[model samples]
Target: MIEEEPRLSAQEMIDRLEPSLSLKRRVRAVAALLAGLAGAVFVSALWWSEPDPLPGRTQLVFALLTVCCLAWAGYGGWLLTRRVPLFATDRVIAAWMGLAASAATTTALAAVAVQRGTGLVPALAVGGLFVAVALVLAVRAHARRRALLRRVRELTGREEK
Candidate 1:
């Protein structure tokens, strides 16, 4: 005889199926939401408040960067609130977002250092570190994606022809 799932209210089903989150996970969610929101606000404010005139293209780039961080905040909020079987984080997209953010931050920092007549070496060192980390993440995401595709093909006995 086939066993059937127990009949339960939606809330009961959710409470039963979902395990309690640990402190680390809770902290991560909060950090993501807070940091993402702060980054978006700061970037927008900084650009708008700049005394120097910014080109239209530069304005667009800043706006896009704000949207990127906002997207992350939305994802984090979603992560914190979901109560049932739902989609998990898309790691590849997350990694790419990280890369984009790292690049934008590093470039802005470097530009500021140069503009302020501050030594470029220190800024370059910090920027290089972030870029390196982003590159590693991008590489890992690509590899993981390829491996998953390969595994799927193996399970289906379908060779890529």
Candidate 2:
């Protein structure tokens, strides 16, 4: 006769796994904090090193967009540091990051187009490509989130809704 091992309850499994999970969370939080810091530094460097003087209105808009990107990255890192459930919130954060990146790229491309006196057609094409990439990234993030949730539910012996 083949012997089968008894399955542990969710609580029991969690209790046993909590220590490792806590460690993993701490490591992830540290990584996020580092990434945020690096991004801030890079943006600052780029802003500082710009060679030409921009119009007051253009400078303000650029500053605002850069700040928004830095803020979003910092907020995401902070949330990760707080050890919020990854499967629950990480996907949303990832999507937001993707959107932010797309916006920044669009802004940069527009600036380049203006500086180079390029026609609208090339700029529009580039913008379209960026949008397509962003959409793919967002979709992948959501799909990964769903997969993670499903796996968690399976591990806990819960039925999928």
List the candidate 1 regions with Cα displacement exceeding 4 Å. 1-35, 38-65, 77-89, 158-161
CA lDDT, candidate 2, residue 16: 49
lDDT of each: 0.70, 0.65
- What TM-score would every model get versus the actual structure? 0.57, 0.62
Q: Report the C-alpha lDDT of model 2 over 54-129, residue by residue, as the tens digit.
A: 6775676657656765665576466554533455355467566767767776777777688788876688688878
Per-residue C-alpha lDDT of model 1 across residues 6-91, encoded as one tens digit per residue: 78664454343333444565677678889889999999899889877888757877887889879888767866785432212344
Where does candidate 2 have its weakest 10-residue lDDT segment? 12-21
Query: Any residue pairs clashing in model 1, and if so which?
Result: none
Which candidate wins on TM-score? 2
| Candidate 1 similarity to native, TM-score | 0.57
Candidate 2 global CA lDDT score: 0.65
